[model samples]
Target: MTFLPPDPPNQSPAQRKRKKKKRKFPSQSGFWTMMKRKKAVEEPARVCGPSNKVELDPDLRFGLEKAKRQLESLRQDLTQFRDRLISARGSLDRITTEESETLEGVEVVIMRKEQDILGLEFDIHWATDYAAGSRAN
Candidate 1:
């Protein structure tokens, strides 16, 4: 069991009751009091951003919003243009590859045709010489 100290004999019943009713944590009471005083003295808070709505003029606010929208539109346009450019470049590369392959095939065919023409010319020259030799004999 806990031992209790005897109340001072000099103190009246009312004083003892008042002392008992005092805050149990005097330090905590001081902190709360300071917080209350600080809040009372402070002004209403405002946003610390680039634009404060309360201070901005109506015309200026409209202009700023319009500029933001324009910037967004331009950004989207740029993205679309860039995508189109990429697609065009891919199409060009594909077309170039196809043309190069077609060119190679055409060159092979031309070379074979040229060889056949040369062979026909050689045969014609040999036949003419043989006919001339036979007529002379």
Candidate 2:
């Protein structure tokens, strides 16, 4: 089974075939839009100049100046921190290098002491054998 809605008997075939009226959006046609366009045309062209000064609200200007000062202070602090870090790193490297060189010198001294002890032991052993042979004779 199929369901179908009956069309209106009063509406003619020509009326049904007629195109829908186009909608008028806010920008397309309006009293305010016309007035705004007219005002824009009447207004003088602003001079294009390279100006550093900006017209900001008093509160905004104060906040901007404060922010700039804070930024500069932060930059100075960052520079100091960087310098200190570099100095510390350099000191640490120098200390490490000095310690390694001192350790190397100590190792050389220890090796020389071991050699001297070995030479002394050899001389003592030779003297003991000489005394024993002389006593046996």
Candidate 3:
């Protein structure tokens, strides 16, 4: 092949060489920008998340109310049980005799009350969720 000069008198040798070696691939930034624009346009319209508002059936509403009341009662019972446990602990510390050994039964009672409170709390949460109608109807 023979080398060719620029057509215009003012055109430089580099310009002539560049014209011969025209780019086949777009620049990195331009390619990324185009892809981003295409992605934005081609994407589905913004998706809406789950709606929290739900209608509660009458039975479920009653159950939820019952659960709420039960939960409150359990919480109060828990506070009383905790206070008793604290007092028992203090009494045990003061009297390290066989009296402390007898207090073991009181510890068991405190633990059972705690378990009951936890169970009630769980029930309340479940009842509230059920009442909220989480399932598709």
Tens-digit lDDT track for model 2 on 1-137?
88755656987656765744555664665778887865543232222234322233344346545655655565566556545645776754555566557545655655565565556445434444443443345
lDDT of 1 by residue, 39-128 (tens): 432222222334432233344446545655655565566556545645776753555566556545655555565565556445444444
Per-candidate Cα lDDT values, in order, are 0.53, 0.51, 0.57
**Superposed model 3: Cα runs more than 4 Å off:** 1-97, 134-137
What is residue 11's positional error in candidate 3, in angstroms? 99
Which scores better on lDDT, 1 or 3? 3
Candidate 1 off by > 4 Å = 1-95
In terms of lDDT, the poorest run of 10 residues in model 3 is 40-49
- Please provide TM-scores, in order, for all candidate models, with all chains considered together: 0.30, 0.33, 0.31
The per-prediction tally of clashing pairs is 0, 0, 0
For residues 41-124, write the lDDT of model 3, one tens digit per residue. Answer: 323222224654444345545765675666567667756765675687775356555654545555566567667656755654
The order of the candidates by TM-score, greatest first, is 2, 3, 1
Model 2 scores a C-alpha lDDT of 0.51
RMSD of 2: 40.2
Error of 2 at 123 (Å): 95
Best by TM-score: 2
